[model samples]
Target chain A: MTTASAEPLLSLRNVEVVYDNVSLAVSGVSLDVPEGQLIALLGANGAGKSTTLRSISGLLQAARGKVTRGEIRYAGQLVNTLSPQDRVKLGIVQVLEGRHVFEQLTTNENLEAACPVEMSRAEMRSALDRAYTFFPRLAERRNATSGYLSGGEQQMLAIARALMTRPRMLMLDEPSLGLSPMLTTEIFSIIRRINREEGISVLLVEQNAFAALDLVSHGYLIESGRVVMHDTATAMKNNPDIQEFYLGGHGVNFRDIKHYRRRKRWLT
Target chain B: MDWILFLELAANGAVTGLLYAMVAISIVLIFKSSAVPNLAQGALVMVGAYAVLAFSDWLGLPMWLAIPAAMVFMFGLGIGIERHALRRLAGQPIIMILMMTLGLDIFLRGITLAAFGGSARRMDLGISDDPLFVGQILMSRVHLTGAAVALMVFAALVLFFRTRRGIRLRAISNDYVASWSVGIGVEQGVALSWALAAVISTIAGVFWGAVQGVDQSLSLLLLKSLTVAVLGGLDSLPGAIVAGILLGVLESVVSGYLDPLVGGGSRELVVAVTLILTVLIRPHGLFGDRSVERI
Candidate 1:
């Protein structure tokens, strides 16, 4: 993974979030991400990685238990008080974990729904064309209801929908979750391609360190509401600490685990 | 009833039905935006009629100027209601807001009674007051004009909702959070819907006043509008209008023909029956969105 030669695009300093009065999800965490770089947030279940992402996006208000005691700057602006929509307008878009692409809308309509380019309809049409070029599967199933799309295809649609907003940065929560290995590979490969070819900065939060670190330039390991380690993907991958705790170590990849096959597996 | 008389009564019922449909359409617009039934809608119509009458008689505005002026005034009044009463109650219980608007209706009614003395005022609106004889049957020229006005207004509204502004309103109604995230001014959109509904209600009231004469008793018209909206669907604008006319026609036929056996006053009975049937069959209304529960 090669780091981009540019100033940091997003920086979080000692950010803290506490739910209710008791649960401390994230505490005093900080990280800097440069432009056009893919950064992965790795942790186990309930690791506060999602909470950190949510705080940056302004979805989880600091006034709530999801409070931020430190500074969060995006493109050199303090965005702690900005609303989620304002954050989105300012080129920070998050695809929620479950790929909740407006289920009632058609695939193309769902893509069209997030369109923030307040230009004439003609401009919007060209934007759609560019988005379709990236995700041809969505273009093919343009008229189909989004609910009918497979998990993989819906993930692609979510990415495409975020692209329509023309964001400089994208925060995706577990793009590979609940997806088949082949689908996961395709999703990450496209994300890597988007980062390399299109210069779009990506901040991805995933439990699968193997897949997430495969594309990220740097990785932040969160454990119990704190960043246990922050290093380059190469360093983190090779570090014994990450392998011992986060991953089951021994380079034992979950993708290689297989069992006896049955004929015609159920999709669900 | 004979076929000849049946057709005549049906036509008459439909003309009146158009007026009720127009009123229901006003209610539907407000309901979609605010999720409130807007009890003042009937009062709004009466206000428009009174405004017109007052302008022509007291203020000396001509018919052309007076009508538009009344419409504009009602539009302001509608926005004022939203800002003063409804805006504070946002996100509150639906029944609480309903009661609040009901209180508004009563307040408006009291003002009209105080100022206008509850007397029906005759106006020379210059519209055709003579009934046109269609062969043996006679239909009032005013009812015919009311039907045409209702149809034209309905068409215009349908076209407006199909436009960008209309899509914006529907989007706000469907998901307020999503609409806000998409850079839509939700407050402005809701206010615009209320204003538009107020304009429509005012026009309906003016037409009703011209046909039936203006009086404080006209506030009962909102009851009919409520019935129309409930039967059609709370969120469906087209449903409100169509259900209104259908209910009107049914009431007409039932009351004219069956009133003899039922001892008259069957229109109210017909509305009650339609309300029960719609609630049982489609709780969301004929054209309202289906409530999708999250798992």
Candidate 2:
């Protein structure tokens, strides 16, 4: 498949994130989310996947992390210095990892809380209506406190709340974490529908390689805070190394595959 | 054992409790938004009362204008404290924030002493202190007016929380990071909490000043307010109100009946004992939400 000719909606050029002014968390990574495209960032644990997402969303500052050496451009404008709230106002919203909904707030209030400060009462109501339509399960439990909702329902609320901002691009961190297989499949399909129907670009970070690669049009494999492989979804799925290590293919013995060889294959 | 005196003391205690509720609600608001217990709350209250005194007595403003003017000044002061002092220390351990508040309490007290001198001044809002008969029992008009005002403020707070803006503030209290992700300004929310707390503290200070005179001892109300907060659970608004009334009535009855028998000044003892009993028996307070563990 050919890449879109227009400039990407969000682009990170050689981004380097440093934590506490000492430790490097994300090093020299570059990626893009073309307009209206679904992209997945696949990585192992502590591979800086969440850090990259946080950097883009301007949430790294809260964690004592900074994008020290790269430009994070959203819609052709530099946004490295923008506050997270400002980023959301500029149409960038992130669904934080672990489905962090306002547990004490009712489901409807959770969405209402996400509406922009300048939004009119009529606009807020319609935005809430749009969110509920996307997640009907949340609508059914609108008045219930979010903490009492099931895991799947909380994830839905998190996404729907993000949607209340009417974001041009939605970045989700591990939407499938700790969810049942059936629920994960159902959520991924809904995400695909949102991308297609709402025309919102998505930058997804996930560990479920099989499901992620199947859903995204393009995928980037990250390791040790750097991108090791970038390819179309079909190409990455067929790569032997990704198949052996990430996709759980062939059930190869751990001792049989040499670590150096695996590293060299991806590096080359 | 005069029934008339007993009824009068109880009625007065209930009104005092309403004032305590206002101050405790301020503490709870700061705690909810920022997880800081605001050791400086009493100082804020004292300063608020002194601000009113400065406006009305020193500047010769009318009581009507002075009260609102003082509230606006205190509101700005609250935001300034949060923005200039506390916001700079974000990402530090909460204990550090608590220590900062402790230090702020001393700093504010010093400033008040240097500026106002250590003298008690009466604040007359023109509300009559004359006792009026409610059936057989007598009630102070000052206390009655204070209670009515406190209840109205409580109603306003309840309605505020139901608005979209208030929901945003509530969302910040729930999770700062989550609130930020959804476009909420966490720092602004915290600052607004401080501003609101300051306004409430000013109102509490005015009532306390009207009754007891505006002295440095006005800051001692913080101790009673803290006890009320602890009894109601530090984060619960309704709990603070109930606890405030309960402590108020308890103090009045104990001091009224037992003071003559044990000399004077048993009211402070009631607060001390109630605080201890609450800690030992119900550490979560009466209305606090208990953390539930899901297996």
Candidate 3:
């Protein structure tokens, strides 16, 4: 993270997204994930975190969403206009907010499905081995139908499937959403290893602020469609506003922060 | 009881059942890949038969050349339709897309009627009209050949899903956005699915036309396949085949024996009752996935 390169791996400058032509989802949210860095994007529900990840991966367009403004750069190239498939080929893959693993497909088949059709058999075999190595639990149930997997296992399969794509930068939304506390800790440890051992850059979006802060060194906090805070995870954790508001702090100023309502619709 | 006649009718039922399932499989293929209900499937079959007629009966090409040419033509037509018409309508409501295909069905049926006229057309696949017998029962070569083809297609489909391309198709079917996130060309997958569905329909057309003779009624046969699709599960390939053959056998046996006592054409009733029973028993279809993902 402290490599201090002139350009970050991914940089979003004043980005704005709107869905269904009229509903303003988010605006002016900007951050950068440096090479080999684990960066967290923290926000509550409807805080536009998932929309930002989807926008970066071009899934917004697929869902009738458009990035009407701002620059999204991935691997130092402007990528707001790219298709989701093309963005993936350029080494950015998003594990969508929910565990969107193909439920009908078997777990092993799902991994193979994520691979490009052009992948060689040997290469695919190794990719499967790598994924299985990352989550031994997934390896145990490799042939089971994904619909039958437990919530935590389904989340693991989703990330393992994304990993099978061999992405350079992995963006995960709500990795700990429905997982048990122990399972969440276990999953985050593997994520850390994936980032550290494999050197894959991570951009994690989560509603679980404490868990996200524990893993990522740098963080961006957006509330109501705009970036309200950006700092190192340490700074974010110690900040009084984030502590009193997000870190389960007591309710002396709860009513006042609720009215911090900056309805900054950026795409207009 | 005239048990020999009953056995022969049962054999005929099996053949007809496979053909009916063939059309259902085509429906399932398109529906599974893109969630687009291809209401034009039967019309596609009719058009395919007409193409074979144009190539063989009109142009005097042999069966060898005529069949492949018609299939390739249908494949291109399918991809072309997807590219020009359905591609732009991506993310539209399912009902809207389904209606568009219904429109396509009428349009294609009208075109076939204009192009080939309302007269019946026959295709000589050279499979011969001779009846093959086992023990006391007799089976037509045409039905057996068509059934064999259907079985082979089923096998090929299983093998296809096991291959990387097939797995990707399944992935796309399972989750379109998720598939795209992992580097799949969703548009291309949808188009390819249409093309495959077209090819299957054309083969069914060729076989059905060979038996029933290509005419306006060939397109209406989609009603039967639709019945099979719903009875089997629109998204289940194996379910389609099983339902197709089951309905076919039921129709054959009932019309053969029960119809004489009941005074004609209760096969439709039997199919309706069976479909109702299937719905009551397994609403998701015999082999369909239990529930699609909500999110």
Instruction: State the iRMSD of every prediction, in order shown.
Output: 3.6, 0.5, 0.8
Over A159-257, each residue of candidate 2 has an lDDT whose tens digit, in order, gives 999999999999999999999989999999999999999999999999999999999999999888999899999999999888887898777775646
**For candidate 3 chain B, which ten residues in a row score worst on lDDT?**
B286-295
Task: Give DockQ for candidates 1 onward, in order.
Answer: 0.21, 0.88, 0.82
Docking class of 1: incorrect
Local accuracy of candidate 3 as per-residue lDDT tens digits, A1-268: 3433668999999999999989888988889999889999998899999999999988898778999999999877899998888888888999987889899899999999999767899999999999999999999999999989999999999999999888989999999988899999999999999999899999999988989999999999987788888899999999876776678777756465654443223312
Candidate 2 second chain TM? 0.95
Task: Report the C-alpha lDDT of model 1 over B162-217, residue by residue, as the tens digit.
Answer: 56567567656665554544444567778888899888877787789888889986
lDDT of 2 by residue, B1-295 (tens): 6888888788889988888988999999998888788999999999999999999988999989999999999999999999999999888887888899999998999999999999888999888867799998777787778778888888898899989889999999889899989889999999999999999999988988998998888888888999999898888898988888889888998899999999998999999999899889987788876641100
Clashing pairs in 1: A18-A65
Q: Is candidate 1 or candidate 2 better by lDDT?
A: 2
Looking at candidate 1 chain B, the ten consecutive residues that score lowest on lDDT are: B286-295
**Candidate 1 residue lDDT tens string, A1-268:** 2333455899999998877666788899899879988999998889888888888777674235556488898988999888877888888877667776656557776666677637568877998898888788888999998878999999998888777777788888889889998999988988887777778899999988988888899999887788877899999888865665456665554443331011102210
List native contact recovery per candidate, as a fraction of 1: 0.14, 0.95, 0.90
CA deviation > 4 Å runs, candidate 1:
A1-7, A16-29, A42-54, A60-68, A97-113, A116-118, A141-158, A174-190, A196-198, A206-211, A221-268, B50-58, B111-117, B122-124, B134-137, B292-295
- Best-to-worst order by TM-score is 2, 3, 1
Question: Which scores better on DockQ, 2 or 3?
Answer: 2
